[model samples]
Target: MAGAETTRDPYAGKSPAAPLWTADFRFFFTARTTSLLGDAMLPVAITAAVLHAGYGASGVGYALAALVAPFAALIIFGGVLSDRFGARLLMVVSDAARLVFQLVLALLFLLGTPALWQILALLALVGAGSAVFQPGVASVTPRVARDVQKANATLRVSESVTLVLGPSLAGLLLAVSSPAAVVALDALTYGVSGVCLLLLRAVPMGPGPERDGAPSFRADLVEGWREFTARTWLWSVIVVFMLWQLAGAGPATTLGNSTLVTDYGSSTFGLVMSAFGAGSVLGGLVAIRLRPRYPLRAGALSMTVWALMPLGVALGLAAPLVAVCYGISGVGGAFWIVMFHTSVQTHVPQEVLGRVHAYDAAGSLVMKPVGQAAAGPLAGVAGTVPLLFVSSAMAVVTCVLLLALPAVRGLTRAER
Candidate 1:
């Protein structure tokens, strides 16, 4: 299954002969960009409010756990529902629901102090919406754009832009206004995205109908799982990705950020992050033009760049040196994301793409929180530097070894 190629796209001849940015694709792109912009701004405002209002550090942890819980729990269900109802329909509904939740949370912050549980519940609502929205978008992109690679690159560039702007905008607003304003602004973006999602007319190719008279949800889940596992290259890379995520996400992202701030100071940390953002933008722009033929293999190679982050920290590099390493990794990350998504969109059949994406999301994320939760305690015993070293080794080894198989090595882009 790894080297398998489809003879024809299901939606062949449907793509417009014009450039990538057709009317419907533009609307779809706008919807995703606006949503990401809001998501980018959200964490800073939430953290500021939680800390400033005396929710304390534990409250932030609790908030993240609350958000992750429902998202993980409902993500598969979201995929099934999206497949049944159509991507645009599900996305619009999800956005509308998130919009309401954000508005309510904003009102609570503006008017009175909501209990921690209440805030968590609202955040969970948002996460659920996110879970539902993600798979649909993955399924929808190939349908929306004539060139999936460029489309994915454009989205990644928008993400890079928002990464620079979102936090800055939130910080600026917090200086002059309240967290409620930030949350309200996020709600407004959701409204805009929802309206845009509702307007998409390009993707008439929805998912297949039910298997029998009334297929159980469990049956659908099984079918998706079978499809996912049918491709060894797909599952093998996922297992490798899961391992690296387990190692890097918590230890590298959660604990590593803390270490950077402690050792180099906030200013240095900001500089390093800014470099990463700039690199991501550059990567996205380059990827728009440089569409690699063997996207899956190239993408896997790019992910190995993440090893530099932990390696830089473990070696006690200077602030600028660490920044440069992370910046390179950021470029690699954008390239990897664009290539990976494009490969999935081009290779996977349209009917089951949503469900498969859900599994992909689940596999990639399932260990991240566990890693986050365990990193602090584990580091206390092993020390952060040693664990950082381990994380780097795991990334390099997993990727390099996976390349030995022909399945991973030989896979190419679908014929247009």
Candidate 2:
């Protein structure tokens, strides 16, 4: 009944003053934020575990890749399942699965030595769960919130807060105890998130549209593809981001970490990261209040700031200067994400939203591993500073190219 009521009048009983005041939204937001806190701990915990196992740097890479590769491979399938079963159901299942996996991981770390293979296997399972969980959240958000823009902005704000605080919390835990302790806490968060999902009743599970007979997975996949390709603006942005992810992600992760940590030390690198996180939070707050007439165009334009990060590295700027650049870049990054998600939710049909989002995510992330793998070798050959400059220039070019597309420039926010 609540689901039907929401379908009929999405804005009913919604308070503009406090979007999260609604019981359903409050529950959903709390679950998501709590899950994010645990997620923030994962990278640190996994890396520490691998290194502790005496596997060294390559082991760390393999372990991280094991987690990411499965998500990248299975995200589209997860989207299809989400669309078929309903976002809430898929999310609940995902949360439960992750809870089990994390608990096992925690147990292994606490009770006995976790072989590197065992760690990789369990991490991959968590990644697969995330592949399902992400699209579910994306599809469900618009259904739960009356003010889509504010809801999205609020979601970004949550992520920004987690980004700022999660690592610090993880570090503090690491300092006092073992990575296993940190992981056990992550498992506890997953349990809490699962409980929150179990308590959520505002959304219901169901299949998408069916034709003359029962729904065929292949047919559904075809329909999703058609929906995705039908929009020039959507596909174009996806393409740009694929390249953007490739060029920007590798250099920032590999070169940025290596260079900054080498020259300025780990503390300075942490300060820069904190500045970036602060800027991201500020950007989300700004987006909450500022309504751009043409959200896509504004978002595209704002993304140019990303180039500043690589430029700072390329120029061999002082730590403070580099931190300033990262802060500006972080603002742009947050603005882009909120605007882009809002735009997609506004334009895409609800039935196929999960699949489309999955496709978009897959395309955007598929190249990340490639970038990560290549960054080291490329940096060795081309030099980190010069490669960073190229990456920076490429980011600018990608944004400009996207802005030049008529579809991208002309698209406006959907009318409520």
Q: Find the candidate with the highest TM-score and give its number.
A: 2
Candidate 2 lDDT tens digits, 1-416 = 00122244456565545454477787788888999988887888878877877789999999888888889999988888888788888888888899889889888888878888898999999999999888887777777676777788888989888988888898888899988878888878877777787676556655433322436888777777888898999899999887877887677778887888898899999999998998898889878987787888888888889889888977989999999999998898889888888888878877678888999889888877788778889988989888888778877888798889999888888733
Worst 10 residues of 1 by lDDT: 1-10
lDDT of 1 by residue, 381-416 (tens): 999899889877876786686687678767887733
- Cα lDDT listed for each candidate: 0.81, 0.81
Q: What TM-score would every model get versus the actual structure?
A: 0.93, 0.94
| lDDT of model number 2 | 0.81
> Which ranges in model 2 have alpha carbons more than 4 Å from their true place?
1-9, 12-20, 208-214
lDDT of 1 at 343: 75
lDDT, model 2, position 122: 94
Query: Residue 357 lDDT in model 1?
Result: 85
